[model samples]
Target: MSREFLPGQVIVYPYLWAWQHERGETEGRKTRSTSVVVAVRGANDGLTHLALLAITTQPPEPDRIALEVSDIECRRAGLSDFKRCWIVVDEYNYDVAERSWYIEPDEPALGRFSKAFMMRIAAAFGQASRKSGRRVNRTE
Candidate 1:
């Protein structure tokens, strides 16, 4: 089974192990959480990029962690627009203070993809903003 995703469509990945908090968790237990898809890109093998929003028992922080997901894995997880979902890290731990919140698509990130893919994602975001009537500031 295959799925098609559009650019700028917000997808959610719930229970995704965003990170681990050593001081908060008990013993060696790791903390887990979910994330939201912020953008999608590429054609040959589209990459699903997400913005892992911060979560908290109380009020979460205003910042968000970003990640690039594989289309194959996303399909396997049945991820879709507006659908809450979760992913397990299985290896790395999440540390908010360190600002490390990304995991490799398969194993490594050495030869991820060309810079063009990033540009495509950016363009997609721009198109979405325009379609939604959101003003794009000319100045940086």
Candidate 2:
């Protein structure tokens, strides 16, 4: 079944980070709240391509690109439990939602980010991508 996805939506996912993939790991060690940055349905492939950003509680290092999540934004994204969080923009997990082995379509989205906030994220992602950001292909 095809699942509807929207940018800024928050969902639970086993997000494989680039570092883990570099170490030959194919799966994330645990499921966490992730932000859906891009979701596009391919006309020819009839598959939904997703670019998901990891929502991490760990503070970003000096060299990494990240956006700090405010308390209000966290609540809006269903992340009130976390003391703090940031959306890592330097890397993302790419997946084909229709053919995904990990995405659970039956599960409802945790919450969603406002369109305004999403615009900021999209812009940051664009910059990050241009700077040679990493991508972990979960569909592979």
For candidate 2, give the lDDT: 0.93
Model 2 agreement with the true structure over 59-135: per-residue lDDT tens digits: 99999999999898998999999999999999999999888898997998899998989999999999999996999
Identify the leading candidate in terms of TM-score: 2
Q: How many Å off is the CA of 116 in candidate 2?
A: 1.0
State, as a TM-score between 0 and 1, how close model 1 is to the true structure.
0.23
Error of 2 at 108 (Å): 0.6
lDDT of 1 at 125: 40
Clashes of each: 8, 0
lDDT of each: 0.29, 0.93
lDDT of 1 by residue, 1-140 (tens): 02333322222212232132322432223233332223334355444333333222232223321234345433433332313332211212221211223332232111122234434544544454355322211111
Indicate the worst ten consecutive residues by lDDT in candidate 1.
88-97
Looking at model 1, residue 18 earns an lDDT score of 19
Best by lDDT: 2
